[model samples]
Target: MNVLRAAIEVARFLEEQEVRYFMIGGLALQHWGEPRLTRDVDVTVLVDPEDLESFVDRVLERFSPRIADTKPFALRHRVLLIATDQGVPVDISLGIPGYEEEAFARAVWVKFPAGEKLRLVSPEDLIIHKCVAGRPRDAEDVESILIRQRLRVDLDTIRQWLEAFRPIIDTHDPLAFFEQALTRARRSLETGGDL
Candidate 1:
């Protein structure tokens, strides 16, 4: 299945319901960084913590859950895993206020060559998201973004968010990953994008 088409459908559904959301994960990476293959759709949806059940129920009307106990699982994990009618898997992150609110405000609508406007997380926000993910692939994405963006990204903002997330996610040092990626990205530029 086409990830963009499925993401577009899901995004449209969210818009119809007036639910605030933005495309994240690999798809957003493709817009800001290096193009890569990502099978599933990942989005951050702002839902009232008190209204999760109804929100999930509302989503169920348009999409089917990939898991058995989607509502309970989403409530516990803050992520709703489901699939579109065309069978493209999607992970809907239950976002709260504060940082997420800011990210939403910074989100941009990128008009593809075919005239499809896909809402994507900003480059700085995308870097933050990848840093939080902390996988090797995520590191590569960060590097590509840094190399492609150079001084365009808000490194200070990224650093600030990483510092705040530092205490919460002790298993992963988001700041360190960003720093390392920044270094490598610079080196790659120095070496003519060989890294």
Candidate 2:
């Protein structure tokens, strides 16, 4: 499906539209963790609910909505599911106010193997994303990222964001979740275990 090309296309389109967005999910994990096959692309767009229809309309020019009623579905779920011309699935997550907006602002430009550069969320922010999702796979991704970028990643920033998101997202203890993941990753690295 040429996922890299698809990602470049989506990034270019969003940049042209002056949308503040960043790549996340599998693609972001690929950047920070061990590379894995990812079928879909995930992007977080800093779009307001009021402007959703216009935004969806613009995206429709190059991508087809996965559902019949894209606007309503997006509004309800805060995610617009669409597919590229080559049938590559893309999930456009509507950015929430605080955490997401901060993540987008912290996104850094990354040059892919294809020599196409696109914005990607910071490693700290990506960890927060995975921790929040809290699935087994997500935790594994977090562990991989930690093992790979151990010295460089900012644990404080990740902790800060997780702490902020705790009350906002109604998470009981984000820091605990992060600590557990970090501990596991550290143990894996110490024992020479493959992540």
Candidate 3:
């Protein structure tokens, strides 16, 4: 199966097991920003800490881990690196209780190109995510999302969430990154140029 189809299949499996998840990373960028070539499907699943072990076992039954001792690694890092039978990568982030909780609560169902509905992180939540990541590419993604979403995207909402995440995510200044990206996006839009 192709990447998109494989991603849809993954989503279907998650839904069948009644797991709460929201598409993120590139797949989500396709919906809110410029479409980019992404090799893997990224998703964040909100599983309680108590059930994490069983949850890890559940997914392992379907997808092959890209690395050895994936369960241990995932338990340590809260990220599961696994792949489908077709060799398509699937990154499942074991979400924690803060921003992730809010992100999942805001997840919205959107129909995929194949006519299957998949829940995805909202544009505002995704913007917060990109900002927190604070990579050059992630900044580009934030700008693209802003440009594409325009006024429809809520800047204040982004700011509010970033402020809430600031105390926890101290590596990069998410609010600063967002402001810079937002400024650049507005400038690019005003100049009639694509970011």
lDDT of 3: 0.89
Residue-level lDDT of model 3, residues 37-62, one tens digit each, is 98899999998889999999999998
Candidate 3: stretches off by over 4 Å: none
What TM-score does prediction 1 earn? 0.95
Model 1 poorest 10 in a row by lDDT:
186-195
Predictions: Cα RMSD each: 1.4, 1.9, 1.5
What lDDT would each prediction earn against the true structure? 0.89, 0.84, 0.89
| Candidate of highest lDDT | 1
Clashes of 1: 0
Please identify which of the two predictions, 1 or 2, would achieve the higher TM-score against the true structure.
1
TM-score of each: 0.95, 0.91, 0.94
Q: What number of clashing residue pairs does each candidate have, in the order they appear?
A: 0, 0, 0
Tens digits of per-residue lDDT, candidate 1, 1-195, equal 999889999989999988889999878888888888999999999977777789999998789999998889998898999999999999999998999999999999988766788788999999999899899988989998888786488889999999999998877899999999999998888888842
**Model 1 stretches with alpha carbons more than 4 Å out:** none
Model 2 bad stretches (over 4 Å): 168-173, 192-195
